[model samples]
Target: MQFQILRDEEGTKADFLDLLENFKPALKEIRTATNQESINEFIVKQVPYTLSAGELESIWK
Candidate 1:
């Protein structure tokens, strides 16, 4: 998932967080009123998740 330029310190592009929630709807169940922690953890986890893959591939492809 890609994060676009922030509209503000606490806001991002309209669909940023929605991407992950759409990928794994169960995430919404655990989501807090604010998405800060979820967003941080997702980005940090992406480093390892992407590196372990053989090649970069977009799910859309």
Candidate 2:
């Protein structure tokens, strides 16, 4: 969920973005971002990840 905000830049508070940029000056706003399933695909390519059975179960809790 944290990574979703990073990828999409949607419904994010402006102050939070500024605070994040303050610590790491390299952080820049993405002008054109997508809140799509594509972000998941991009992440899987970089590092293969699998949700454990417990993790899956927790989602509906």
Candidate 3:
């Protein structure tokens, strides 16, 4: 149910939109878990942590 579309720089915008429109019905058929359902499915425990300003800056770099 995943698609990776490559867009050409020279392609017309209308054509790209039309191609996407073709997938509308199929896209509607795709199902996704709700936030609570997704959290319930994860087996690992998540811990929250605070990052120091210096650590955050280095992470961006």
TM-score of 1: 0.25
| Shift in Å, residue 59, candidate 1 | 14
**Residue pairs clashing, model 3:** none
Write down the lDDT that model 2 would get: 0.37
Winning candidate number (lDDT): 1
Each prediction's TM-score versus the true structure: 0.25, 0.24, 0.33
Ranking of all candidate structures by their TM-score, best first: 3, 1, 2
Local accuracy of candidate 1 as per-residue lDDT tens digits, 17-40:
444455455544555635635544
Q: In terms of TM-score, which candidate is strongest?
A: 3
**Stretches of model 3 off by over 4 angstroms after superposition:** 1-9, 31-61
Residue 58, model 1, lDDT? 23
Clashing pairs for predicted structure model 1, backbone only: none
The list of candidate 1 runs beyond 4 A from truth reads: 1-23, 33-39, 42-61
TM-score for candidate 3, residues paired by index: 0.33
Clashes of each: 0, 0, 0
| lDDT values, one for every candidate | 0.40, 0.37, 0.35
